[model samples]
Target: METTLRKSDEHESISDGNELRHGSVVIAAITSCTNTSNPSVMIGAALLARNALEKGLKVKSFVKTSFAPGSRVVIDYLKDAGLMDYLEELGFHLVGYGCTTCIGNSGPLKNEFINDIQDKDLVVASVLSGNRNFEGRINPHTRVNYLASPPLVVAFALAGTVSINMEKEPLGTDLEGNLVFLRDVWPNSKEITKLIDKFVSTKLYTKEYSEIFKGWDLWNELKPPKEDVYQWEENSTYIREPPFFKDFPMEKPPTTDIKGARVIALLGGSVTTDHISPAGTIPLDMPAGRYLISKGIDIDNFNSFGSRRGNDEVMMRGTFGNIRIKNLLTNREGGWTSYHPTKEIMPIYDAAIKYIDSNTPLIVIAGNDYGMGSSRDWAAKGTQLLGIKAVIAESFERIHRSNLVGMGVLPLQFKEGESATSLGLTGEETFDIYGIREIEPLSELDVTARGINEEELKFKVIARLDTPIDIEYYQNGGILHTVLRNMIKK
Candidate 1:
């Protein structure tokens, strides 16, 4: 970690722990299938935006807001409600349809805005109605990104920044500098229900989606294979099958002695799967993008990393920490690390690449509730692609832990009050776990942390394999591979 790495001007997670300021809103989006799929929340946002517009409220000019629904029909209903104009007027214009801000396809933060933020060290925050508000998932510059409802996203755009809590203070001021409180503009459940009942017709779901199912031109353009096993392309960037899935030997127990195994990285608490697998702009200069370009893929035509899920190369290189991940080992503020076999700090992604180069396996150690938010399969798949054989954490997010098992990456949990930090574990120590064959639900396994002091520290971590099915999935490589194999047998 560079001593000169300046702390961010405004460092606030979703929890409001400090003051916020008014300024640039780099990415103000109402996205994610999780929330948008529910018509009630969508209609509520629309109604609130409409109410704000009726009160002569306006979105700040600098806010780069957009509506990127997981499915396209969200737009149709918004139009049907006659609220598209209200959202558009507030800069919530329609961007591309699938996961946008949440997955780091935040497009571009404008040049002037970027300059303002970088120069002024502006206190900017993105209020998005999406799941996952991890550090760098949105635009890279905005520091205080908050996760809220769609209405709150619109409210923040109107207010300009997360300066004041919408729940407490007035959202804005009038020409007379009169305060406009959130409750004053907020639509009650009854009012929203009326609009939803009147505007959101069932025909939109039934008729519109039926036509969509037949095919939209965008979906039709994607050339998915009819064959069960994807044809592994030697040079394609969008859809190459991963090595983990190809002829993986399931019966082989943990090879390379868990007791003697080297520690690749040490992580902290609340280390979401986003830290494990970043879903963002694939920098053309990064190793992943370079690999894509080497495969004859044009840089301009290179879509986001989120869109290239089937490709193991792109996902593998994109794994571990957004450019913004802070490795506690090196005290570095951004990017993943490559730990030396002896535990020295190097570039994160570069470290994994080094381990691969040296034929060494990798593991991630973290605190409680690891891998929260979203049912994104890539969260697990990306980690597996990155060569992480197992994830030992304090606790696991329900979906992501399952996702890890689905990807054949073993998931382990530490006993109470035990974590990477408390155990004096750093990124440099090689970790070894034994009795994997005896792992079961709430089963205990011996974990040994070998440090430079040449001392071995051993403890027990809970094996999260709660089900026979989970054990089967781990044995098969991953959930998808297991399913594919089962389908073949059937």
Candidate 2:
């Protein structure tokens, strides 16, 4: 995590070898749909916080603590059991009704705190009970993201760093100037289980969920643009008419060999959909921001990439636009990368535009666990828009690989004990992936990488078209395109 975040981006960042700088806990959130749905953990966290406050333990002043329960029932049960007051006293307050800290919806860190993190090169930590702890998926500056349980999040908030072995070291000094360790306030499992068993009932869930559809007053009251088919607004920045179906004929594209494919971005392991299908803040200087400005949208009105996903122009430009994304082709981080042949440093979107203009097919070469984060379709969709015909990686995450096929992007796996690094790929090599004419589920295919000096290295990759249906999706250009064709046939 430290290695990735330290790279230079839009804002100046810490360089390597300063990994052990000042450590602090900037955000400690017990927020997510996962743990909050489990009553034992939510009640357990409140109980733990209650015990800690009684013992004069306080969370670090800098730690931004929030409790975003999964639903209203979780809140009701905690309040009914008299645990909300205890939880609030120890700094965990209800911030939002839905995903708050997780999904990078975590609101701003204080300017002073932000300055401290940047100026001091402090390696701050965020202890989130939320599922994803992928680099840059949480707050960008919070480098060390720990996926802990709700109770542990509260504990880390009080302790203030992952540096300490809480069992061995003191979290902080209590009122009497005595060092306090975790055991001093830690609630045992038996008590937590007993409290959960006594308080949580099926009646609470039944009653809360019974009116789920009817009670969304805001949604029910919303008047959509009354039309059977959505009227695509050309001037709207949020959405546009999808071009995939509009510009092309209703015919399956031929499965031709991908030759002279340029490597757009060379990535290491664990590149999340968040990196590709960006969600949070759009900087005024980035590609998406510039495009929005051209559309008469101010920087402040740029919103987030997530809110504007319906716009292919913005979504395509926002691909690899994440401020924290690391494109290994350049020594620096950010959404910028060196456009091959030109060696000119430009935003990823600009280079992709250039490549598309020149009719160059693009491909991403990556290490293990490529596309590992959220199961977002736009991740694959964005790749296809960028002209990426194939992805040759050491391995792939299951759903993402399927999404790639759904977008008609070929997914390939490196033969065991082989990787881009192992094969000495520097992201400059022109790759030719052939022998996919009769592509099958898990069939072996050839990938030949040729250097500028004309030196060649060849390897085999397994086609990750998991099923025959997946192959059909690929042949028809995409899953949606295939479905449209099937409907026409019927």
Candidate 3:
């Protein structure tokens, strides 16, 4: 994680002996709607860049820098204020006008840097003007991520590391060899407000919005099918018609007891949707990556899971696939699980497929506050597609619980003061849940766990179908099913 700079004739401004220490800011992005939409912060960042340029400071070449504003209007205002040049000089070139690094679409790191990072096992960092800094949500190589204001993101790029104390440490030196601290370049409130008032206007917004629907030439050139039912491309890896209704039955099937269900994953607390379904770069070695490769796609063209979300084949393989997820069933980290039938350690998707092939139902056992982050619908959809019939946890995030119910995957809450750990449930038991056929809102249901030695542990769980509408959704096999059936009847 350290690099030594050698003075070259092409770029003699860089000092020959300068060294970039550990904790290098590999990715410094001014992206995400949370900050980019606010003119105050955006102006503040540009002003700071202007000041930094005046002092003859420059961003380290090793750091990857990008600026992706939430709206196109932001670029107009920055140009109006004549501050875009300064930002560009400092390496904050415009990448796009929407979510970039924030959603893990920051793209790949340099090959040399990647090799050095892996060889040294160095822990690099990223500073972004984004709201989400979840574990493994940023670049996979970036072990540490910090959420900062837009200006701070630029400052870190100049400083080349997050390990420095902005209050006291010098970001770099000027041409006169004078040490420059962050305070010297920080923008004042009056300056920010003045720029905002002078450059940002309602007229500019209206002008930009008028052409919003008239997409660029490339978008306008493409033709869509006029058929009543949309045709699916079998060879396309990006979009495919989902299989949610492929096996739909006109008549609702009677709810039966879940018997002999196996555990797909035994997760711990605060398991976010990010862990259940990552939106970042698709690793070339994982199941999703293999699927894409099988389709003749190169490693470079394997887009993010979020980009390929329309294809259930990719998303299903990505479920529980976060590189940092810890499945208690396996001794190692990541998306690994132990298939009960073969007792083989394999990817969670592989195990789920095996269970599905055997016509066996699967359940997930977890600790408290399960599914607590970013109410991602794919978290529930992937679970249902993987044949997970129920998710039994000590607690559930409200939106994710609702999503599970909407997807017809039962959300069962453990009784008070009881959990997988407290009850000594090792997730190695065949589970049976009764009373699902007679389920009602907030109803208590009986559960039995049979161990390998024929010992049975019994417990009662509260079904998370909290409303009459939730019951209707579950009975029809999902919210989509209910809507489709109702439309057909009409």
Alpha carbon lDDT of each predicted model:
0.73, 0.82, 0.88
**TM-scores, all models, native as reference:** 0.80, 0.88, 0.94
* Model 3: pairs clashing at backbone N, Cα or C within 3 Å: none
The most accurate candidate by TM-score is: 3
How should the candidates be ordered by TM-score, best one leading?
3, 2, 1
Error of 3 at 304 (Å): 1.3
Model 2 spans > 4 angstroms off: 1-21, 188-198, 296-302, 322-324, 438-448, 454-461
Give lDDT tens digits, candidate 1, residues 198-250.
87777777877788668768888998879996676766667665676566543
* TM-score winner, 2 or 3: 3
Write down the worst ten-residue block by lDDT for model 1: 13-22
RMSD of each: 5.7, 4.8, 5.1
**Candidate 3: Cα lDDT at 26:** 86
Q: Provide the lDDT at 320 for model 1.
A: 70
| lDDT value, candidate 1, whole model | 0.73
